[model samples]
Target: MPEMNRQITLAQRPYGVPKDSDFKLVETDVPEPEAGELLIRNEYMSVDPYMRGRMNDRKSYAPGIEIGAVIVGATVGQVIESNHPGFQSGDTVQASLGWQTHGVTNGDGARKIDSSLAPISTSLGVLGMPGLTAYFGLLDVTNPVAGETVVVSAASGAVGSVVGQIAKINGCRVVGTAGSDEKVRYVLDDLGFDGAFNYKTSIDYEASLSELCPDGIDVYFDNVGGPVTDAVFPLFNLWGRMAVCGQISQYNATEPPVGPRLFWHCITKRLRIQGLLVSDWADQHDQALREMAQWVTSGQIKYREDVVEGIENAPEAFMGLLRGDHIGKRVVKIG
Candidate 1:
């Protein structure tokens, strides 16, 4: 008898927001790695906003997840067995192994994890994709100079939190917007942002932004689109730069969202807005990770994790993530 592996698969494509019935969990025999392949026992699996897009039946930057297929995700796990020359048993690695407790990969897209530098979980969050997204999205895309005002939407999230901290490290006055008051405090107090506000409770977006960003926004790292982004456009300073990361607010829309037209701000302010993908800077990830690791070690950057235990609970945890229930990076500790 072989060891059994529990896996989560996309049972149905989500219409608007995902529900419990959209995902199905089943057990299967653990697969054996062929020659040149490695077998991994996933320890922690990441739950991200981008996964919401994958659940839809449409083509985008990446292929959509098919029905009854394992949902795509990043995982950190130990290499329980390896036939690949680059890895060995007892070594930990990070790979896009989806929502399975055990998976076999050809080692093409896998990276070895150095546990001595940071926790293995950080490879799925900070020092990993989200961290890399913030590093390049802020520094490369926006190119904020010291003394400029930087604003981040979804400031308490995995990516936005890092974006605000990196801006602060660069000597910029950072302001962030979160969904709740507690989230706002975490961004201002724990992450060292100059100011933050809860967008959910705020009656006037313009007033809130104006009070926090009196100097106007020199650079904006947008994670949640819609009204939050709408409010940001009119607040831009001359020669503003915007990094369009994820549009979490509109990710689950069944129809196109209608909002105030704001492209005119781009023309008037000479704003440069660009979308970013972490893979765009894949060639330079090693260098970026080195610098990010240093910041984490020196306490220049701080991170939090909202962890759920068990593979069975992944769907609920992921649904909560989409609902803005989790404060930080959401991961499932798979058994």
Candidate 2:
């Protein structure tokens, strides 16, 4: 058995955007799994915007990642040995192993995966948290309809990209906003968005909405929540629905960014706005997986990953995600 372990440890608490100094790459001996546990080496690890919130000391829906804690993340792993019930040697699984080369699990959170269906790393993406977020966020919250106008922010991201395409598949008129013209083109030309705008260069987000969603927006998937969400707020038609999946723009703000309030419109238009966490919807994942898988296989829905080459590169890629430097779901390859 290999006796080496390479891991990234939290070295310091970050005040804003995390820096290299915040993480320490440490090497040690591989740990032996206890009874009812599995010993595994992590393969691919996920890097997401929400993990940034965990770094801060402030309270959130989930407990923050304490200083010195290995950064928490989703990972794809191969079980090297197991004493856990239902888990076996050589079984591939999705485990919450965080940022490390080796991990031990009680088998409670480890879900067995079949590599025959889709890429296993996809468990961290389109068929995993991001996929589940897009699936339930769109269906349960937005409750879209055929031929209705649906608008989304961060249109080419892991969550937003799938969100928009699923809306399209439902027969909605989809329009999206992304950070670059290239991303806008990808949304419009490739993702089948009826229209898309580069939010970075657009003179007015509301104006862009007016031009693209002349029929008025029936649903808004709010991914980048600062200014872009503000722009979509007023354009919503009566009885509109909004799914507040993520707010990437404010993730790195040193101070709270100023945003226009549209509380009155929510009442006047009878709009609904609610934030959703994918973890809270575990009961419905089987249905989501079956439906989403069919869509991917049928080519009616598409997903993309902005894959970074190594585990050491996750922090940089994640920092870029906060800066809108990436156009799709960011994944770090650890194998």
Candidate 3:
């Protein structure tokens, strides 16, 4: 016998773009299950650019959140009741618990969350998906061959910031682009990117890219698409590699931004452009976390967090992410 709970759901299927009205906050009786399931109260949830794509009624790497249904998200929580053998009432776990206050699990998808070793919230940021995304997306995809030149857009974001630093660690010359002068300096000075530029200050994406990457680019980790992507195309060295990560510039757009006028350059260079969702590499999450954590503890890697105060402000924090308002990993605190 237990008390039920309420959760939030999608208010509407976004048309072209999402609005705050598209999300519906609702209350419902807590879910109870037959057997081999666990019920828990979620603590913290992560807000990511990829979540924006889920708002639209379209097929993607994962199913989109349906209208009047709870929005999907990654959450860390503690089990309060359990009939499952693997989980107990006090067990801490991380899973796709969604944008609600509570959730029930079959005990299949949930993974143990260890707060004793590191901050529990890190499961959603540095030590979790974002970390793995930056790792595999940059190292595995781009290769960042030693002494080569690497450039990443959205240089100071969760994944971008880590990607640039890792590239430097691998002995590649790295440059990055950000929205503000402060972010530019953070990547260049703090993160040790060989160079950094503020894209907002220079409208001509090609000119800016040319100035910063005069040696040409061997690896291009594309975080934002549109004009920056177009600018990066011509600078690609022969057989250059491009990893198409989250495209925040066009995430809120009613339509995808158009650019890349230099498709011919790609053909001539025989460049390889690949798109990957970090979830696709879930199998490697643990390995990446272990190595990343070691680097972080030793000062070989650095992380920055842009934290929003409360759960109620999750939407505003998400909005800031789309507008490039955050300088690093963005998270919201919930109690």
Q: Rank the candidates by TM-score, best first.
A: 1, 2, 3
Estimate the TM-score for candidate 1.
0.99
TM-score of each: 0.99, 0.97, 0.93
Over 233-309, each residue of candidate 2 has an lDDT whose tens digit, in order, gives 78889999999998887877789877677789988999998899997788888789888888888888777778888
Query: After superposition, which runs of candidate 2 have C-alpha atoms over 4 Å from their true positions?
Result: none
Query: Residue 74: error of model 3 in Å?
Result: 0.5
Off by over 4 Å in 1: none
Ranking by lDDT: 1, 2, 3
Candidate 3: give the clashing pairs.
4-30, 5-30
Lowest-sum lDDT 10-residue window in model 1: 326-335
Estimate the TM-score for candidate 3: 0.93
Superior by lDDT: candidate 1 or candidate 3:
1
Q: Give the winner by TM-score: 1 or 3.
A: 1
lDDT at 48, model 2: 88
**What residue pairs clash in candidate 1, if any at all?**
none
